[model samples]
Target: MMKIMLVDDDRTMQAILKTLLEMDKHQVVLWDGTSESDIFAQIVQEMPDLILLDYYLRDRNGIEIVKQLRQEPQTSHIRVIMTSGQYLRDECLEAGADAFLLKPYMPDELLRLLHQVQQNG
Candidate 1:
């Protein structure tokens, strides 16, 4: 099991993600039913193995968070998956996401990506 963070602003998405990850025995950290706040500092302290971030968050864009994580030496290596309804694969990749997932993605797709990341890393 891996320690993963689900950083989407949508409560439904967060619940779904948490349930699915927990089903597979992966430990999941959430936004605690609130918008991601001071997320950069929180992430640095928590240091999960991976993060699944929404492209357009309630408080800030996921790319900005990704960039900050990459810029900081301590959190730079954590894998991030950026998901959005809009097309942002290239931009998110450029921002340092390990993978970009379009919204409404299937559970298997997300699971496959996680497996791949763990395998490669």
Candidate 2:
């Protein structure tokens, strides 16, 4: 089972993802979007196998977060799957995400990507 981190500002999204991931036998870690300053540190500490990051966060965009993560040795190697309501797959891939899922995606799509990433890793 993979340890996954869900970083999004929406509590409802977090709850839904947590339940889905748990049901899939993955451990879920929620990032409370309270402070962007501490986000990197929290993620580094958590060191999850994969991060499911939303494209638009309240404090900052996921692109910036993914860029920062790619720059840091502590987080550079972790798998990241970026999600968005808009179509930004190219941008997300350029920012270092392993994959991008447009919001309202099917659970099977997410699971397939998760499995694919896990296998590739």
TM-score of each: 0.94, 0.97
| Cα error of candidate 2 at position 54, Å | 0.3
Q: What residue runs in model 2 are displaced by over 4 Å at the alpha carbon?
A: none
1-121 per-residue lDDT for model 1 (tens digits): 9999988778888999999999989999986634366787678767899998899987689988999999989999999999999998999999999999997889999999999988887
Question: What are the clash counts of all predictions, listed in order?
Answer: 0, 0
Q: Could you give candidate 2's per-residue lDDT for residues 1-121 as a string of tens digits?
A: 9999999989998998899899999999999677977778889989999999999988699999999999988899999999999999999999999999998998889999999999999
Q: With candidate 1 superimposed using the best TM-score fit, by how many Å does residue 71's alpha carbon deviate from the native?
A: 0.4
Which sections of candidate 1 miss by over 4 Å? 33-37
Model 1, 57: alpha-carbon shift in Å? 0.7
- lDDT for 34 in candidate 1 is 49
Note the residue pairs that clash in candidate 2. Answer: none
